[model samples]
Target chain A: MIWGSILGITFVVALIILYEWPKLKQGSKKEKATVVVLTGAGWLLAVLLVFFPEMPGPTDVIKAIFQPLGRYMEK
Target chain B: MIEKGRISAFQMAIMMYLVVVGTGIIFIPGITAKYAKQDMWLSPILASLAGILAVCTAFQLHKLYPKQTLIEYSVNVIGKIPGKVLGLIFLFFYIRMNAGGIRIYADFVAGSFFTETPLIVIISTMILVCAFAVHGGIEVVGRTSQFFIPLYVLFLLIIIILLLPDLDFKNLFPVMGNGLMPSIKGAITPQSWFAEFLLTAFLLPFLKDVNKGRKWGLISVFAIMFTFVVTNLVILFLMGSITASFTYPLLTASRYISIADFLQHLESIVMAIWVAGTFVKFSVVYYAIVLSTAQLLGLSNYRPLVFPLGFLTMLFSIWGVANETESSSYNSTIFPFFSLVVQTLIPLLLLLVAFLRKKSGRRKPN
Candidate 1:
């Protein structure tokens, strides 16, 4: 099942790369850098998440930020 | 300059309606019932006032800037550093909120129907569709919403009607018997929803006729408020206080639709249109984030950001929740306060600051 999902992930990444590569090439240096960096970072996070679904994401980060306040409100 | 497509004011109205109604209608009925009991329907009406305030304030900002979104014109109101900082905060807020919205959508679908499917699958699929729409720009999102809104309403209203026999109008009795404070408290959550109209700042700049913004803005708020009232009433009549027990009162009520026993269990259809509504919602939020980030970075286009953002969105949606318990608690408890501050209070502050700047500018004539 894990391998299957990884294969699915690879296919998706490939498709996105194909779709974006030309546009990324045509864009200006700033645009190219922004797109590549963002797309690369996003892709890396998504792939890691696909392999390790248990990895903590945004919810914990947010809960750490807001949960204290939420408890304070209840008091 | 990334987005050149312009949509008519009416289309903007539809997009606003879809954005507000997107994931809200699914869970709000149950959540409001927990606080307001039978008066859950009234909460939305009360919430509408704040929604109006949010839309109007965003409109006021738009009127001042005319051609710039909240991101661009914000710099002119405040000094450069603060304006850019606020703009960055707004971009982050929209992106994170969009992630949370997708998480809510994934949770609902997974909780209700797709028990066997992995959540990442659901989150990623929806994000891809939304990223595609966001890539097409705001015009596509607006036009698509305009086409889907009526059909969504028709089906939703049909389900509400089909459940009439089961509805207990007696459920609404003893209205505010617990007094108005609870209902007012209930209003807090929906107010966050209503304040989401601040998203209009993004659409306002691209409006074909900026003059009609205020009129349609109010209309969108009214229409959404009215839908909430109707859906809550349907849930009340069908389940009464029992509405509080169900996680999704609207979905639960929809399951009760049995016309002569042959027409029943049409929740699949409800789920489909809901997915459609969420698609619109995701696109609007995602487009707002992409456009804001592009403008903030001085990029030439927003399209490059869409695919990357989609991945990030899916990652955020899946992260943090240990299980369903964490998701639901976050949704009910902290979410309202979080939304109200970000969606309502921040925009209110910006509006106040803009007003002060206007006054100070006139004084400079002396």
Candidate 2:
């Protein structure tokens, strides 16, 4: 569960930064507030995922992709 | 004057060695063992000869035209249209090769350490790191390789030393029991990897001293050969016949390290070293792709393309194979000939055309 939150947080933060990079380079003041809000939202989501461990969630899609490879190697 | 970066021939050699020897250290032993069995060490020696030939061909081309990259010289050698077409082909090859390397690294990490990590995440993170390094250009890549190569070599030597106790000398016995054909066939897979030294064409123009280029190229090939030979022998000594069955024999061997039961599970250390090597390799290939693309398309700024191209590369790495088995199958079957056409045949053809054009100019009909 802790790992899931870390993944969720990292994914969100990375996406937000990637989105804001081009806008920051473009020097748009209107986009600056949007970037800050998105970043904050990303952080908030991360924290919620971390602390609220019992929150109902969908299955981890990433783990499903890798599980087969792991099983084969283990064998 | 075409390129601003200035790396010494020695730095170029180190960079090339780092790129060539990266993921192969962990995976080649198993791949070769599958074909050559106990004779796996011989495969790299044979592959090294092919590497030498490829490097020598590239060096001769560089010597013929010291100031121009392969992209530029191809135009001077062949007609502009033909040269541009060839350059495009090379650009595509490097792009695919870079993506393939990223895939291999991501797959290995996902298969071993980060069981739950998304392969896309692992691959994208690596591509992000490489894109940043490549944006800094060739000098940054060379210097980084110089700094990390020694440490990588040291770690490799330390691993070999630790595993020495577990090595069974008899496992290497009954040499050539299946005869030389298997080892020869095994050599084909790695020979493609060795031929990657052809990248020196892109790097040669940036080298500080053209004369040392060939010497450094040979040195890089020898260094790669030494690494492969040592790794194959170690896996054979430690895992014996079962080495072929394991996907990553070197990592497994490192995992088996048990000194007083305390020095176990050093696969993370191996992972760290492998990541460093991957960084250098990815940077080199990424830089080559960007520079060659810029040269081909007449783009003044290569920086803007870095992120978009990296995203595409990450996507390709994810989609390149359905699974690890397909990836390995591609490596063993199609990769050698693909590498030969790109690395050896194209460059050799360009060199010959350049020479013939010069000869025809000198002997014009009066």
Candidate 3:
């Protein structure tokens, strides 16, 4: 099941790259690098999430940082 | 420069209206009712001050740096490293912010209607559609918003007008029975929604009629404020004290519309409003994110970054939000403060610094 999810993620990432890579070929090297880096980062995060779904996420950090102010809204 | 397409201030206004009112009307009435009770309708009026302030700050900053988005001008206002850091902070804030929005949208769909559909499917489908809009740039987004506003407004009024018979005017009594504090407290949540007007900082640079930006922005704020006031009153009149009990009071209120049992199940109108408004909202924010990311990275083109960022947003929406309760708690509690600091306070500070620096520069030349 986990491998299936990973494969699914990989397939989607591949399709995005495949569809865009041809267009990126005409753009600057920097733009192409950015596309690779961003998609690669997303792919890594997806795989990591598949493995460790319990890992803390951005909302957790935001909640922690803002909890002091957020407390007033709590019932 | 990255965005070749230009939108008018009126289009910008329409987009901003949807951005605030899209999910806001659905989620906010219940939350505001929790505090404001009978005075929930008043919260949006008071909260609109934040929208005005945000528009003013963004407009003033645009006057100083007329050609650049917030990400680019922050560098000019605050020096390179700090400005870049600020840009990244904004980028992070927006990405997470849009994620929460899309999540709220998915949760609404899945929880209220599509009980059997997978959340990932809903989230991804919405993201995919928004990606096309963002990929089309500001022109596409602006035109789409222009096309949809009338329909959106019509559907909204249809629900309210249909519910007129069921409304009880007495629910508005004891208007301030608990005094203004409860309404003020309720205003806090909606204030964050209003603070989202700071997003105009991005669209302002791409505007064709830059001079009309502030006027249209204020008009948009007033429109959203009016919409919220009307919806809140309608919900308040219909449900009164029990308004906070339902997760989506407006949705429930719309579900109540039954004229001769023929105009029944009008909640689909609410669903239409949600889906369409959220698409524009997400596309606008999504465009901002992609454009700013390209600027921050000094890329020549933003198009390639669109899909990747959309993918990231999808992942982020599903990231920390384990369930509807957690997401709502975050929205009501943490999100308001977080949004205020990032969206409202930070831009105001940047504007002040930009003005001071410009003054000192003029004095040095003299």
Candidate 4:
């Protein structure tokens, strides 16, 4: 059920992007197709990051550096 | 005036207040509780005094050059090269601050409500929205803040009122238990946030009624101080000693609100309101950084630098501190001195130089 909803939302978002891209590209020649593809890829990554829930990359690094402060306050 | 936009002193004041009070209301109570314990509310009063001193410095500089921004007048006050260097430093600080705010808000949302959402998505979406607002220029940003400040205040009042049932006034008693030093130390972090009012030096020149600038500035400071006091008292009353343990005391307080089960999980609502305020705050700081950079570089337009700098800001925010703990430590230990030097001392020096220059008849090329 959750995966279905996620996929449905992604499809709708892609359709909206497709509808908006041409209008947004009317004045610019900076690879409209490329920008659209990249944006779609970004949305996909966002969805994966949400669903996968990895061990934490950037956030954990931050937490590790500040662990001393946290420990100090805990004391 | 170099800029075409004109905001009323009232709008300018509200914008300043929104910027200063943004994320502080959420996280500060926790940090204050950690150090000051029951005396957390008093820290804001001290912080506000520091804010007032910083504002005076900014105002003096503004008075010296009535219609120029800090970027423009710094050149007149401290020679061209040094002025540009100082402007760049200010620009970098504002950019980093804005990015950090974005990250913090993103982290808050991810931790509290949208547990499934990626932090980068939350951060990027908010920054993109702020970038769009920044593209609209100062007038749009000012008007948006005017619209949100009242809503933010109303939400805060509602939260305070709801938590009234949970509040134990006794929790705030035995003030200054560890003597004045801890509270004063707690005040340092907020004073840095308050010293951000010096950004008003950029916005004041664009105010329609410059004479009302001082009144509005002071009002903004009071509003911010009131916000901090209310937030601290509520957190202290409700959470007591454990207040320091939570990452966001205000959010925790909202979560503690359980009126017949229907009002139980209003954390999402609070998050929405906070995100709105953070939006305005981010836009203001980002806009100031871009404007100052453009002015310093003698650019014909600031529009081009906006997106590039936004990207850099996002990167720097991610790289700025190792974690929330480091961020909080920086906020508490070092930020006060940082703010005092950048927002207070430099502006005072500029004001003095401008005053001396005027006395020597070096006023502008006229």
Candidate 5:
């Protein structure tokens, strides 16, 4: 499972880089920066969520934050 | 100038129908029945007004800026910084909600069809397919929906007609037996759904004939309402109160199609067609986020943002909820109100501001 997941993710990462690298190189600095930041954050989130799913995720955090409000609304 | 593709008002209307019916058709009967029971059909009848309201608000805004999306025109009404802040909020909200939507699709597919497959596979594959369509931009998305919607309706009608033998029309009786309040409760969630026509604001600018945009938009709203009413009636007739028992009442109802025990369990065909609608549904959501983000950030093009946003969407979908109970609970309790504010209330407020700005602009010119 781990090997397959890693291989699949690696393939995806390669594809994205291959498609994006030239565009990034040719883009103005602001466009290049925007792509870099968004892509980097996306990769980080995907890796963390994919490899260690049991770790408390956004829904868990949001559910906790909204739990009190949700209870109040439910009432 | 950001989007080069041009689509007709009719294509926009079809896209609206797909967006409106995407998840609502499959999941609404159970949810509405939970609140309205036998009178579930009435909820859509009344709830359609909100959809009309949403489309009207979108049209008025489109009138003010026939060439701009909500994100782009928002700046022309407000100052640069606040406009950008609004744009940022819109981007995050869409990405989050769309992630939750994608999660719902994954949950349904995983729960019913592919128990052995990892939820991520179903989730990512759907997102990838939608991303591919979204990458083609609005024209491709519009044409794809125009192509698929007829086939989708045909299959849906097939399921409805095949189950006619099993339908108990009396199950829908004791008309409003529970009073109008429960129907109102059912209408509440659907009203939020109707408000989702706010998405049409994004498509309006790219329309070839802005003059007919409102007519087609309203037509699409009525079409959605008609589809909902028919679906709820079909579910009530077929499953009776047992409509609330299954997580996916439409899918369950389709499984009941038995002609000489030969045509039993048409779940595969139903699911395939449903995935088509959902594909168009999520594609629009993805397009809204990517295009809006690019516009907000002053980028000349939006393609670079597509997969990054798609990746973010998959993560949120994975992390959105634990199971069906959580998803439905969120939908019933908090999501309706949230959608009302985001899709209806906020847009209405923006329209007001734009109105004031228009009046002031005329004054200055005088």
Candidate 6:
């Protein structure tokens, strides 16, 4: 199931690049680089999530930071 | 201008209304009821003040720098490096916040209706639709939201009307029996929802009727407050103190409508409005994220970044929390304070800094 999901994730990423690549040709080098970097990062994160589903995310960080105040709401 | 599309202030108003009321209607009544109890209706009125303050801050910032969005003007308000850092913080905050919003939508759908479907499917499909809207630019989002508002309003009214016969007016009694503090505490959650009006900072720079921006924004806030109050009252009347026990109180209220057995199962209407409203909400936030990212990275166009950002948003929503309980608790507690800081406090400070800078610059001429 995990392998199948990874394959699905890769396929979606490839399709996104394929659809967007033609449009980026008219854009600047910086535009192309940013898109490539963002897409690659998304792909990496999705794969990492598939493997380490227990990874602490942005919400965990936020919850940690706001724990003191959040405790007040528990009442 | 990264986006060449222009929307009227009225369109901006409609878009913001849907953005706030979309997921808000479903989630807010229950959450507010948890704290405010019988005084839940008062919470939205209190919350509107935050909305008003957010709109005023965004508008004042717009007046100071008419041509730029919050992301662009932050660099001008502060210095280059710090402004860019602030801009990045705004971008990250928006992305995370939007992801949380989408997660709420997905969880509602999955938990209530599509029990068998995978959440990723639900999240991705919604993101895909929103990406297309964002890809079309600000005008498309504005017009699409405008197109959907009447239907959204009509269906909502239909549910409210259908449920009218069942409401127990006695539930409103002992108003503020706890002496206003519980409702004020309840206002904390919805206040954060209202503070989302600061997103107008992104839309204001693209308005055709710029002078009407603040007027229409306040109108939007009033409209949202009215929606929340009405929904909160309806749920309170229908379910009383039990409102908070259910996850989506309004959904439960609509589900309770079985007038003569023919008008039953109208939760589908609730579901329709939920999906439509959330689409607009996500698109607006998604558009903000992509536009700010392009500006932050100095890209010439924002279109290519849309899909990539959509993917990231989906991932963020999935990774937002482990389950529904965590998401709900976060929404009611930490998310409000986080939203207050980023959306309200930070922008107000930025505006004050910009004013002082202008004053000192004028003194330099002496």
Query: Native-contact fraction for each model?
Result: 0.58, 0.00, 0.85, 0.00, 0.37, 0.66
> On a 0 to 1 TM-score scale, where does candidate 1 land against the true structure?
0.94
Q: What local lDDT score does residue B55 receive in model 6, on the 0 to 100 scale? A: 96
Instruction: Please tell me which predicted candidate would have the highest DockQ against the true structure.
Output: 3
Model 2, position A8: C-alpha lDDT score: 67
DockQ winner, 3 or 6: 3
Summarize candidate 4's per-residue lDDT along B217-304 as a digit string, tens digits. Answer: 8988998999899788888989888887887888878888999888777777788788888899999898898788768767555554
Model 2 chain A poorest ten-residue lDDT run: A56-65
Order of candidate numbers by lDDT, starting with the best:
3, 6, 5, 1, 2, 4
Q: Locate the minimum summed-lDDT window of 10 residues in model 2 chain B.
A: B311-320
Q: Rate the local accuracy (lDDT) of all candidates.
A: 0.83, 0.78, 0.92, 0.75, 0.83, 0.92
Candidate 3 chain B, poorest ten consecutive residues by summed lDDT: B254-263
Pairs that collide in candidate 3 are none
lDDT of 6 by residue, B1-366 (tens): 789999999999999998899888878888899898999999999999999999999999999999799999999989999999999989989998898899899899999999999998999999999999999999999999999999999999999998898889999999989898999999999998999999999999999999999999999999999989988899899998788798889888888889777878999889988899999999999999999998988877899999999999999887858899988888889999999889999999999999999889989989
Error of 4 at B43 (Å): 0.2
For model 5, residues B1-366, the per-residue Cα lDDT tens digits are: 989999999998898888878878766777788888898999998888888988889899989887999899888878889889888877877887787677777878889999999888998899999989999999999999999988998998998899888888889789989789888888877887788788888989999998898899999889999999988898889888787777788888888788997988799998898889989989988999999999999998898788878877887776646677777787666667667767888889999999998888889966
Model 1 ranges off by over 4 Å: A1-11, A47-58, A72-75
Per-prediction DockQ scores? Answer: 0.53, 0.04, 0.87, 0.06, 0.44, 0.78
DockQ of prediction 3: 0.87
The better-scoring model by DockQ among 1 and 4 is: 1
Candidate 6, residues A1-75, lDDT tens digits: the string is 999989999999999999999987788889888888999999999999999987988778888988889888898
Judged by DockQ relative to the true structure, which candidate is superior, 2 or 6?
6
Question: So what's the TM-score on candidate 4?
Answer: 0.82
TM-score of predicted structure 6:
0.99
The runs of at least 3 residues in candidate 6 whose Cα sits more than 4 Å from the true structure, single-residue gaps closed, are none
Candidate 4 colliding pairs: A62-B322, A62-B323
Docking class of 4: incorrect
Stretches of candidate 2 off by over 4 Å are A1-75
lDDT of 1 by residue, B169-208 (tens): 7888999998998788778678878888989998898888
TM match of model 3 to true structure = 0.99
